[model samples]
Structure formats: structure tokens, C-alpha cells
Target: MSSKSDAKQEREIKIVGFLCNWCSYGGADTAGVCRFRQPTDLRIIRIPCTGRIDPLMIVKSLIQGADGVLVSGCHPNDCHYAVGNFYARRRMEVLKRFLPYMGFQSDRFRYTWVSASEGQIWQQVVTDFSETIHRLGPNPGLHQTVDSAPAVSWF
Candidate 1:
């Protein structure tokens, strides 16, 4: 008989996580150092700050077949770069609402805050997001169905 983890691996799900170096990435590192048990579906990308992540980056991930996209950073008023998290929050919120119109479910995208000392919270965040991605299954991607891609440019 297969174990639970084996069963989880039966289906392939990929979640891309964009973590702010000052906080969320540190939290993930702390979680790893503490040996926290969490799902492995998430692949982390460390960014200087969430504000630096363009909304188009998330869209590109979806179009390239990422099952889910998660953006995490420091709590509001706690960003290392003053207002980076605030900027990130607004951009992500707009993207979240606009996802469905792009043929991608909004639930497959998320944004949250976490500090370096919050290892447990980070673990919970990753676990919940991973479970959500698994439920959504694989992404069909934009280029898969369309013969020609639309011109995507943001000023």
C-alpha cells in the first residue's frame, strides 16, 4: 500500500511562489531550518521586494503553465523598503480580480504577508496554497489553445 505522500505525488501540481527577500523568503528559510513539515508543490523565487514583481510576471507564469502563483512579503507598514508591500498588495489584488477574465481562476493566485520570525505561519501558508493548487490541477496555458498570442504590453 502507498503512503499518503505517495498518493499526493500521484498527481503533478506546480505552484510558483514569489517571496520577498526581507521577510517571506526568510520565513521560508526559517521553516526549512526548523524542519517544518509542508507540501513540496511550491517552487520559490526570491525577489528583492514584492513591489518589484510586475503583474505581467504572474501572467507570464500562468501562460507558461504554472498551476498556481503565490506572492508573499512583509506585513503592511513593515516593508524593508517602506511602501513596497503596499504597492505589491494593490497590484496583486487587481491581478487576482482580472485573472478570471484571462481564463485563469482567481483562486489559483494569492498574496499574503509573513515575517522572518513566522515560520509556522509560513508553513501553514505554503500547505494551504499547495492544497489549493493540487485541487486546481495542471494549467492549460495560454499558448496551448490559441494559434496566435495577443500583444501584452504594460506602460
Candidate 2:
């Protein structure tokens, strides 16, 4: 029974989290310091600010085989960098809406606000997102043919 449970854990989904240093990253750190139990599926990447995260970074992560992506930043009006997270919110919203047109599931990417003091919230957020991704299963990325280039050429 233990081995079966371990095997189930081994099949857990893979998720990438992009956390803003000033707030969300601190929240995650606080959660760790508080010994909050959180899922092991999310791998965190710390960035200076959510505003600095390019939409393409999330897209690239999904295309590269990440099962899901989560972006967390400071709450609006509480951002250390003033309105940076507001800009990030708008950009993330656009990306969430545009993902489906590009053949990706919008639910696979999510953005949220987490304050440095919100350790428990961070744990909950990670746990909920992990569960959601597990339900969605792995992202299939773009299915393409050797003879066919992407509809939108990067070059």
C-alpha cells in the first residue's frame, strides 16, 4: 500500500511558479519558515517583479513540458514597486485569454496576488493550483508536422 501511494506521488503533476521577489517569494519563504505543508509539484523561479515577467516566458515553459504555470505577485496598491503588479495583472490577463487561441488550455496558466505576510495563503494557493493542474493532466503543447511551420513565424 505504501508503495502504491509512492507510485501515485511519483506520477504527480509538474508545475512551474514564477514568484515576485518582494512579496510572493517572501510569502513562499515565510510558508517554509512556518513549516506549512504544501505540495511538491511546484518549482519556483524568483523574479525581481511580476512586471518583469514576459508573457513568452510562461508560454515557453508550457511548450517546454511544464504541466502548468503559476505567477504570483504583490497585492494591488501594496506592491513595493508601486504599480508594477497592476501592469503585470493586465499582461497576465491578456495572456490567459490568448492561450486558447494558440492551442493551449488557459487553466494551465494562472496569476494571483500573495503578500509577504500571507504564508498560509501561499500554502493554500500552491496546494489548490497543484490540485487543479493534476485534474487538467499534462499539457500536450502544440502538435505540429515536420513539413508545417508554425502559423506565426518568430523570425
Candidate 3:
């Protein structure tokens, strides 16, 4: 019986979270302090600034079996670098366009602005993103069919 349930949950969506070191990370910490339970699917990675996020990183997450990606940072004009989030926002917009072209769904990536003081919003972001990904169904990346071919003798 436990095995069956485990099998059912084995393919659960993997939500990768990129959090800004100063604000969004603090917000997530606050959520924990308040006991705001979030989905277990999310795994957080802290970076110095949202601007440090690269399109390649997001692509690599998908390639590595992430069902979804969430990026959270300070709001406009609130970035520690003064314009980091704005730069991040523009980068995401362009990346979003290319991911779908690469066969990933648009909903697979999400971005938000969460400040250190917005603990509730941070909690809600995680909750809502989890639910949305749940509704969208499992990530197709997990279902990739590997081609098993016999090795040929090079000699």
C-alpha cells in the first residue's frame, strides 16, 4: 500500500525557486517563522541579485528535470542594485518567449516581486504557484522517453 502511494507521488512536479539573497530570501525565511507551510516540491537557490539570473540557468533547470521555475526578487526601485530587478524582468520576458519555442509550456516558468516585509505574499506566491503547476499537470520533462540503442564497435 505504501509502495503504491509512493509510486503515485514519484513523478511530482519539481518547482525550482530562485530567490534574491536580500529580500525574497528573507521573505521566505519569514514565511517559515510564521509557520506558513508551502509545498514540498519547491527547492530554493539563493543568488545575490535577480539580475544575476541568466536565460541559460532557467534552461538548464528545465533540462535537468525541473517541472517549473520560480524567480522572486525585490520590487521595482527596491533592488539593492537600484535596477537589478528591472533588468531581470526584461530578461525573463525574452526568455519566456524562447522556452515555449523549445517545446516548454509558458506556465512552466513564473516570476514575482517579493520584498523582505511581504511574508504573506511570499507564502501566497509559493502556494499559488504550486497549485497552478499542479493544475497544469506533471512536467513533460519527466516523461522523456530515452532512446536505448545498442553500442556499435568502433574498432
| CA RMSD of each candidate after superposition | 6.3, 5.6, 6.5
Query: In candidate 1, how many Å is residue 120 off?
Result: 0.1
List candidate 3 segments past 4 Å from native.
Answer: 1-8, 142-155
Looking at model 2, report the run of 10 residues with the lowest lDDT sum: 1-10
| Model 1 segments more than 4 A misplaced | 1-11, 143-155
Clash counts per candidate, in order, are 0, 0, 0
Error of 1 at 82 (Å): 0.7
Model 2 regions more than 4 Å off: 1-12, 146-155
Q: Which pairs of residues collide in candidate 3?
A: none
| Candidate models: Cα lDDT each | 0.88, 0.90, 0.87
Residues 6-98, candidate 3, lDDT per residue (tens digit)? 544768777999999989999999999998877888999999999999978988888786878999999989999999999999999999987
Q: What's the TM-score of each model vs. the native? A: 0.85, 0.85, 0.83
Clashes of 3: 0
lDDT (10s digit) by residue, model 2, range 1-155: 56545644666678999999999999999999999999999999999999998999999999998999999999999888999998999999999999999778899999999999999999999999998887776665566656766586688
Model 1 lDDT tens row, 22-82: 9999999999999999898899999999999999999888878788999999999999999
On lDDT, the candidate that comes out on top is: 2
lDDT (0-100) at residue 20 of candidate 3? 98
